[model samples]
Target: MTVLTIIADIRIKPDEVEPVLASYRNLIPQVLPEPGCLQYDLHQDNEDPAHLLFFENWESRELWLDHMKTDHLAAHQAATDDKIESLTIYEMTKL
Candidate 1:
């Protein structure tokens, strides 16, 4: 089985950073109990307060895709639409 690692590089608009950050915070407990969710943690860039990073480890790609379809994920996406300056997701596996 492949172990999937996901990195989400997120940037929030300057004026919306604080509000969008709350959205990020709200995702943690909701994700931790989900199946195949080995890890789901957030990080912030030291030099840039507007930048946020999420590191996720899942049992497989399919499980991660399932996560994307969840209501919590959709709600967060909807809430952050205007606040996000940029959103980039990278999925990887061990060589």
Candidate 2:
């Protein structure tokens, strides 16, 4: 089976890191139990507390797409909307 890897980098506003991180922490457990989810780990950059990264592995691209449309994902976006400085997502396939 091909695993779909998603590397998401989230840069939070200088003073908003804590709240944003809290919201993301709340999101982790919800995502881990989703269908086709193999791994969904969150990490913070060593030198920058405001830099958060999500390293994810899903069974397929389609299942990941379903995850993107989940209510919890939407709630997370709403909670951290203006507090984020930049967001980047990379969708990859394990070779």
Candidate 1 clashes between residue pairs 3 or more apart in a chain or in different chains: none
- Residue 40 displacement in candidate 1 (angstroms): 0.5
Error of 2 at 74 (Å): 0.4
Mark the regions of model 1 whose C-alpha exceeds 4 Å error after superposition.
none
Which TM-score value belongs to model 2? 0.97
Prediction-by-prediction clash tally: 0, 0
TM of each candidate vs. truth: 0.95, 0.97
For model 2, the stretches where C-alpha displacement exceeds 4 angstroms are none
Query: Per-model C-alpha lDDT, please?
Result: 0.92, 0.95
lDDT of 2 at 28: 92
Q: How close is candidate 1 to the true structure, as a TM-score?
A: 0.95
